[model samples]
Target: MTSPSDGTLVAEPRTDAWEFGDFAYGLEPLTMPPVGDATVSSALVPSALPPCNPDLVLFRLRLLAEGGTPDLPDTFTDPTDDQLFWFRWITGHQISFLIWHLMGEILERNTDREIPDRASLARLETYAYGYCAMLLYTGSCPIDLYQSLIRPRMYLQHRSFSGTWASDFVPVRGLFRGRGVARGDAPEAAGLARAVDVHKTIHDGIAARLVPEGRSLLQQTMKETVVRPSERTAILYDNFFMTLRAPVDGEGITSQLLRRLDAVASDVAARGLYPLGYGGDERPKELRSAEVAHCENRIGHLLHEVGEAAATPAKPLS
Candidate 1:
């Protein structure tokens, strides 16, 4: 593994990494809808959206399924140091992906139920808006294990553990009973299963009260009942509803937001993290680091951009 400045590590990309190339390509020219002064009497009622807006949820799931195997630039690895930078980078990316997935569950529920009340929308918006901020933060800082570990501690000390979004999803170990993909599982099937488990556990817990319908939309998505995975991706692309709201008095908004974002970011990073030079590529150390960082940056930027865009209502594509 190559260590870089600020204790960051970079990993080499593999051939399979290109699986995400098309999705990545689709994400180019990403832009957020302007959060203008147009205030709806109620936060409900579907704000005007753009045609074919990017879906953070589906994009995130696809990213997670793909993992971080892409060929990264070489500048991120520093051999002279014993730091675990690459591990941290991957950990952060994974967390970002998970966070986006959870948020998707929230949006799906809100839209399907036609949550028409402004207060409800406000709560959802609170989460949605913070998600955007998180994306920006991740894109710019790119959390590592070090940051991940530290942030959680800090958040727990000051914030209320209840009412957080991820509090809904169950942990991966608890959800998946058998290891290795089933006979019919696809190449990415195992990873997708793990992702679904995570999504189901978390969303089921977090929005339990709000979505009183029982069984999260995430579960439905998995069953291919309400929406197919690919169709969910399109829905994610079309729906941009900010769930993060401004902190109210006595509300630990900052701490809550940070904790939730950090959790997902950390999880995703862990999933994608790989050791540098593990593949036996003869590429120069510095070049390899740069390549990894490039991929990390791409993932990070997409997370941030998607969050920003999701803050606004997505219009139907003509």
Candidate 2:
């Protein structure tokens, strides 16, 4: 890939694995076959099992990727102000913002437009479905769920006056056009719809695991927020490209981000799982950790692909 650096175009070689789809099932959880000698199933090891069903992973991932406020389960007990805040933070704005940032970055790289600063690229809209599909199919980041404001949420700040700012969203109705989706639909339109579906599933799954009060609280919150029907895709392709402006070490920025994300996920599982208690059925903890890790891996993999593609130099004709 090529990019201008001090008036010189720098190029990097591309890898066979440097594609968004390459990471779709990159880090699936392993299910071990029972072993006779060790009594420990190989399933416990992530690498032991074959890759997960790409279709199902993609399905569950759709839920995890596009999280929102309405996805929460019903509330059983009243939430403390702090708990409510965290719940909101986890289920909505922050996660949506991060996904937008990633999608924007991809669009910017492909179109040579500054995505963060502009709105609605007529040119990129044609490829919107394909791009949106790839992002939904490949984008995942568990760490983003726990945090608020991944990229300052400023990209769409100016567009807030336009139709409720990411509300009233309707999913692509079906695989065919007029089913809530058409060939010309904006990327974010289809993107947000899938996000809502996935978010709802996640809340339901979590609520089922928690105690009665916990489940009730989640359910209550879930019902409180209602998404209005959206007229068009809320955020559109822009020309402004985003930059971290942070110093890059020996490894590239993508590598650094992945490393940091890995650490964050590890720390979360290490501290978060303690409540489950030692020897208190590690399966749930392991499964949760693996799932979170999978999401982190998908994000890291996509970023690496985007970074490389952005830097790819034009090849000379033979």
In order, the Cα lDDT scores of the candidates are 0.32, 0.28
Q: What would the per-residue lDDT of candidate 1 be over residues 159-206, giving only the tens digit for each residue? A: 221211231122222223323221215443443343333333333322
Estimate TM-scores for all models. Answer: 0.23, 0.25
Q: Report the C-alpha lDDT of model 2 over 27-115, residue by residue, as the tens digit.
A: 21111111111123222232211212233323323333333111221322343433333333322232232333334433434444323
Looking at model 2, residue 135 earns an lDDT score of 28
Runs off by more than 4 Å, candidate 1 = 1-74, 78-152, 159-318
Residue 198 lDDT in model 2?
A: 36
- Superposition TM-score, candidate 2 onto the true structure: 0.25
